[model samples]
Target chain A: MSDIVEIHMPKLGESVAEGTISEWLKAVGDSVDFDESLFVVETDKIATEFPSPEAGVLLEILVPAGETVPIGATLARIGPAGAATGASPAAAKPADAAAAKAAAMAAEVAEPATAAAPATASAAPAAHKGGELLSPLVRRLAAEHHLDLAQIAGSGANGRIMREDVEAAIRKQLQPAVSKVAIPPVAPVSASSSPASPPAAKGDKVVPLSRIRLVTAQRMVESKRIAPHVWTSVEVDYENIAKVRARHKDRFKAETGASLTYLPFVMRAVADALHAFPAVNSSVDIEAKTLIMHSEVHLAVAVDLDEKGLMAPVIRNADMFNVRGLAKAVQAVSAAAKKGTLTPDQLQGSTFTLTSPGPLGSFASAPIINQPNVAIMATDGVARKPTVVGDAIAIHHLGVLGLCYDHRAFDGVTTARFLDHVRTSLQERDWEAEIG
Target chain B: MPTNKEQVAEEVTYLDAISQALAAEMERDESVFLMGEDVGQFGGAFKISKGFMERFGARRVVDTPIAENGFTGMAAGAAICGLRPVVEFQFADFISQAFDPIINVMARHHYRTGVPVPVTLRCPFGGRLRAGPTHSQSIESYFAHVPGLKIVAPATVEDAAGLLISSIRDNNPVLFLESKYLYRRLKVPAPLSLEPTPLGVAKVAREGTDVTLVSYSVGVQQGLEAAEVLAREGISVEVIDCRTLVPLDIDTIVKSVKKTSRAVVLHEAARRLGYGAEIASEIGEACFWFLDAPVTRIAALNTPIPTSPPLEDAVLPQTEEVIETLRKVARS
Candidate 1:
């Protein structure tokens, strides 16, 4: 007899159900050695290569690369040890061999059972034959309940049975009937134990808060309790800025290969204003009783990631980058944050922040200050409307800026001046000169 | 003080039961408080919180500004600071204004930070009284779409009181949608204890094998009434109250559908993108092979609820619609 070797895919992990074959190092008809790299599989979390278990000629490859097979499934077959011609009988056409093995087992069982019975009893009627030992009704009921014939152990003549056997089997498995009993209802708990006291009796349900919203709630509360927030709103005439944006947008995109947005313009204005009023760029130290002025401005731009939530990704050193560079950074950071692929470093280090509810046409929003930052600015929805331009009312691009600052750190006057600076910078933008 | 006999046997509306849950939770747990427009001295627009202010005082039972966004945000803050805030939206329709706080920040807080927001937003939704488009609205589907936010709609007074307590003690943001129509209608024997009803569990209000009527809020009552009416006609319909929409009790739904092989989802919200659609889809996916008929949804028409009584009646789903849908599902 030849030893039959069963080849199977190695179990990768406890939870891994399947793995994709990334590469196959061995080819058919190639001589292989033990522990040789056979193929690599890639799972969602990690990738690893499987090694050959035994030394032999590569007889067959059951699975191919880029295919995912279940654990214990045949992956490849290797010739058994000490086999002639380097090919074991076990490696021969698996399908035919399996069929031959099944046929032999069936014959072996039949040979013994038939020899013990009378060879010729004139072939008992088909209904009373060994194969038909189970009555039609019994067979039908057994099939309906998915019961095995052998498990039932028939008790009729020559171990044959009728409908009574099937019914008995079912009755044995089913519950015995019993008379119903009535029980009095219990009294409810006193009103004191009830959460909805006084009016609510019992059988009330209570649900809890979600994690993300809970954190947001906590942060907002802490910010409000710790930071003395004072709001300053101002309208900005963006007539010149809008004109410059429209004129240079195509050129800017073509030159830099980055989409130009109103955010870049607003960011540049805010950066310049921060330089002009350094106090707005500073934060109040609640513990040290002093204001900490940062040398660099790490601007945190809050992006609406979804309908319900906002995420702020910082663009380090906003003062150092021009409008085009700011746009690129914002686009990259915002994209990364939205996909939840941002690294730890990407979300950290911010001295100031900006939030916008654009296109939705929110006129103004009082952004909660990112703690330790004395101020945060918000850009409102921009729309074209009639505005006083010099001596005449004309349709010019206009928008409102809502500035919220910690009153303890920066006074309303300082906040107002910062807004004016941003307004002046946007309204008086000489795009050609600024870009150069 | 003499014990008033009326106090012992007095009947209260389901809305009052909800308020009582809030009041009791607030008194028992120091962290519990009430926050929303008119929830204080005004005692809630629906008067659910009526007399709460005199009992709990202004500090705990506080009224808020018209700023839905602002007050909701503040309530989120209070919840995070260890206070359990039960926010009452004057009308479920007004909840859209605070959608940001409910969906974005509060729903995400627990998943992002591992800290729970024990905040419950109470919305009096649904319509039968000609409240028109503004006052009567069912936006439960909007919040149910969001993860990490538990959506609970109690059809019976027992659930109304029990769900409120569960929401307070729960460690996540919960959208408690109270049906305004059922607030004074459905009544049940008071539960034996104040224990919370488990979330994600469905109750088979009435059982039969001909057809399954799946619903929550006022729809559950409608389903029950429909089932009763159908029973007299020899079509046995099972009514299931899906108290929670998010962590849907899919097992119960699947088992019921497997036994009955037919199902109808009933809700007061518009048919398009409504919670009923979600239920129908889930049922089809889970019990497809077992289903004898395609899941049918009986919901309000896809239109803004009109002011006229005739228009409103035409737009909103009724017991007849549920019964018809059940019959069709059963036959198919």
Candidate 2:
């Protein structure tokens, strides 16, 4: 028997050329038993503890922990003391291992240093069998698009797929889908269509868009891309609500310490309408092909941030609150949004949304729906207009409410009915009594 | 008539810039002195110290015999005694003769003791003048492995002045590897801001988005030339000049490689175990996910340089080879 048995790194799996010595279980000169765990080796595929081939006193450690080396590199040496003669007392399969060792020793004597050659040769085809020869960037890009690597042709050296090759394949795949539709090339530009900004003039001030604005832009584009939208509008008579506000405005402000606004009245009507028409207050799980009709109306109110950007903070359980209670909650959330102090929780879980373009004197504006909500309504300007009432020309306060909905959630009839319900509640509900 | 700033910006060669930096440091500090063979009355082997003996006097600029080990050891002792001694080697190839003093004595002394050794050895290195194997050699890879020594190889005329001053002022042993090929071939506006180019910071010589060429010393000039020719064929290339080999600024290299997704490391040293291997390995580990192709290396053949011009040209990295590598990487 040899005096010293050199411990070499074992072949770790297919395509594993090297591994890191993550840890050593025993220090130098420590006694070892055959088939006992020795050290931990971590390769790209797995981390495993290797066992001692020969039981002896550990003589020397060539490769220290935290160092990586190629396969077949010497790791340590086991001296003759306490060495096993032919088998071990605790070996799991002594006969099989002894025969294998004899064969390996014979092979080693025939071709020294050729142990790793066959392993490397066997690993090459197994590596090429999976992904063929695509670079890391190309592999990630292909995985992102759910592309089959075997189908795409590579143009790099040795047919290795490069980044440009993957990108070219993606462009080629998109051509047929685009040209199949005879639609005009004048379609609205997509978010990814124009990655670069238009050239600026010599005197132009090029300030990068704020982070909030960028996020808002990306979400808006994503919402449009996923949802097919349809818009519906309805005119509401606010004459009765205006008269009630005239009677109770000063008292309501003095009692609540908050100014009475038409937003609360509109929010009250919206909540009631959402309860009446549940489909309009529901979200659609497109992947699952199901509608989620939330029981409570968590209303997301759009707040403008001093012309910089927009934020939508939710008013939890808006349906449970009356006009005055809704007024306080809306004011608190709007103030928080303006002050940049809204928590992430306050901005999520909205089942319905409302955008007030009326303050800016806009009419019949179509606001994008805040996802994953199914609908968003815009309350436009309110003004006194001459209208015919029972065959007589009369002056009335009126406003136009526009509702944009995901067509997949509900059809045009549902959107129209939901808006009309809000209009009826706003025009005929006892607003004076409710405020008092 | 030239304005004050214009007169201050008079052009100078790379060799003149080196001479000016040494003179400036010696004048600024009384403790600073120059010691090398023929550095005094003979005015240096390359005429770098032509007027140093007359201006600073013989005491400040002392010439020594052709004994590298003796003078190098003397410089180490002088540095420990609080004097800034700048030693010059005629050719970087001859540094091996003094390897014992440089590696064993000067390099480990400061680490063992808290005392600082401020010795700067000026080595005129690189091959292009048919200086044969003994005279034309790059020794950066040899010294880069040492722990206590800082290595800086300046490519441009401006850096030849600024980096040397920084090395002289540094409170550690620094090997200032000056390129003998670019000593006269490169020129820059004189009156260089003699401000120290901080060690371990890389400079982007040219910016492009297609592929990055990481190099230093003479390789930087070759990369720039290759980038110029590749631009005509619509292949963009970014060139990074690693001014210092020790305390390498891998951040800049990684950033460029991340943007370009491909890289090529170039050097004039032998391909086997050269300084470029370290840079290439660092790039592989840092920018693994961003690589579109393997990190290629274009360097001298793994053989000693021959005396013949044609043979030397074949051994050393050339602009055409760099251009070809760039084209391959850019397309990949």
Candidate 3:
């Protein structure tokens, strides 16, 4: 084994490609043990302190504070306390070979030839591949240190730079001005280049969407594009449903430990209606030009995520679940979505979707169809208003039901019939029969 | 205060100013368009975009069905696809039909995905024109509860044009609630250029010192009228027009309240749980120490807006109510 050992920055996380050096714990010529704190680096998400991997005297500090470097770049040199300045024959040979292999890999990766050539040519043939050209090791180092090869000057054999050469360049550039360091003024890249434009200017702050939000946006856009949607709204007399809910509130809560919401009852009614009118519960296979109807109901309930808006998590085999089960499922999925703990499986595979604006006071709303699904049911706020029933004016608990369907898959008559079924099921209080 | 140009130009309505803003923006940016019921040939329920159909044509000045939800959703989709769509609700009260698209979808678009919904909803709101309950409402508070939605209620004709233009260009979903009562009643000279009035900002409509009167929409005019009356009585009142409600321009409210140490919020909406509650709460939270007296809110009585003019006048907050609230707060 060679006596000289190379010190490189380590990869910290899966997505983090580079980190900015926040501070250096030690200086050049400092003796450090393996696993000793060396420097602190900051990434967009988090900051962490890196430790030395090899126990030896730090021959050179190759990077400086406030400079960003990539993963696996040579951060420093660690060797025996009194080792010779020149690389050992054995060490130098493999380093040269590694560099040569990296150069070949770089050529395959299609890295900018002009930018990487000098570093690849100067590094020893073995070290050329192993160092900066483009090896797994160099890539990892570049990611950790956030080092851009285009900026560094390579000093390896034939001007082919290795990892060490890149690190040396970074260290030289970052060093404090000892004798009026000739620093070039950073030119304004562009008006848009500023991470965030100043507040005085008409600028905006953009935050990237989390995984759930991204999925929601994509699904919504897809739904709108794929589905030619037409909406029909009808105000239903929720008098019976509200009365039933009020009467059995305590009993339902005691039995299930879950408050009976209009949502679960609505979901149950929708499921029963779906059973009768399967076409409304079907999805179109755009590629196959076929309508796929499912016997089992996988109902997606739209859950409000407060500031993050809405996400739909499906309740699988919803037809089999009772009102209590539906409520539990809705609550669970909603909790998972709000907390952002929902797995991919939890979000996928729904035959139909339901959305409600709750008490935020929308009388009626046409919900966009969840793509691939044939229809979506949107329930509006329940308000006590006067309604005419059989030529008699009565103060009924009125709630508007908005049904938006893909006209390509289902016709207005079919959707209206399905909505009628939903209305009848809710008014009848036949929960057990519907569940059965 | 009539300038030569203002005296020469036909006295344009507030709705006309808004139409001018839309026409100007559409001409300036190819990405800007208008979508609402009867916006194209029918011109709009209030005729705000009357000549827009001829000027911009069908593609840009779109006539949508009475499906508030559908059109609002379509506008949101268009906005996401890099188009600036100004959607008009025939009556602000009818906006309830499009709540999901506005609050759930458009308002949350940016915060959820960093994708902007540069969509503007121009609603002819408020009561007193005998439009009755279904047509008359001031539901701006309903949208103000939403996080990413910017609510602008422009009082003056300048703000009517500027805020509508600003709302059109904003990178967030904006609710531009124009008082139906002010549609034809207010007037101003045509703007030199189509410049946007900043959103989430307030302006001191009338300067005073004894008490600060904060209001928006038609209530702003009432507040200004009340301020003039109070000024004669030696009560210096500062009247503030809260142009945008959601981004409440709390700094300006706080600053004015700090100076006056007394405030009276006037609105034509229902007194209980109206947007006045929000303003009063904000003032209490931010300027509690600076306040000499509790923030008083003078709003319409909690009742369905009546159709009879006298009944409507009785229920709605008038200039007298604003004056009364100012006097009360000032004395306290």
TM-score for each prediction? 0.44, 0.52, 0.43
Error of 3 at B226 (Å): 0.6
Range of the 10 consecutive residues with the lowest summed lDDT in candidate 2 chain B: B1-10
In candidate 2, what fraction of native interface contacts survive? Answer: 0.36
Tens digit per residue, CA lDDT, model 3, A271-335: 98999999988989878989999888999988887866788899999999888788778878888
Give the proportion of true interface contacts each model preserves, from 0 to 1.
Answer: 0.00, 0.36, 0.00
Question: Residue B225, candidate 3: how far off, in angstroms?
Answer: 0.5
> Per-residue lDDT for B47-66 in model 3, tens only?
77777777777999898877
lDDT of 2 by residue, B97-181 (tens): 8999999888999888988899999999999899998998988998999899999999998899899999999998999999999
Window of ten residues with lowest summed lDDT in model 3 chain A: A90-99
* Residue B53, candidate 3: C-alpha displacement in angstroms: 1.8
Candidate 2 or 1, higher TM-score? 2
Which rank order by TM-score, best down to worst?
2, 1, 3
Computed on C-alpha atoms, the DockQ of candidate 3 is 0.01
Q: lDDT at B42 for candidate 2?
A: 85
In candidate 3, residue A174 scores what lDDT? 63
Q: Which residue runs of candidate 3 sit more than 4 Å off their true CA positions? A: A1-436, B1-8, B190-193
- Candidate scoring better on lDDT of 1 and 3: 3
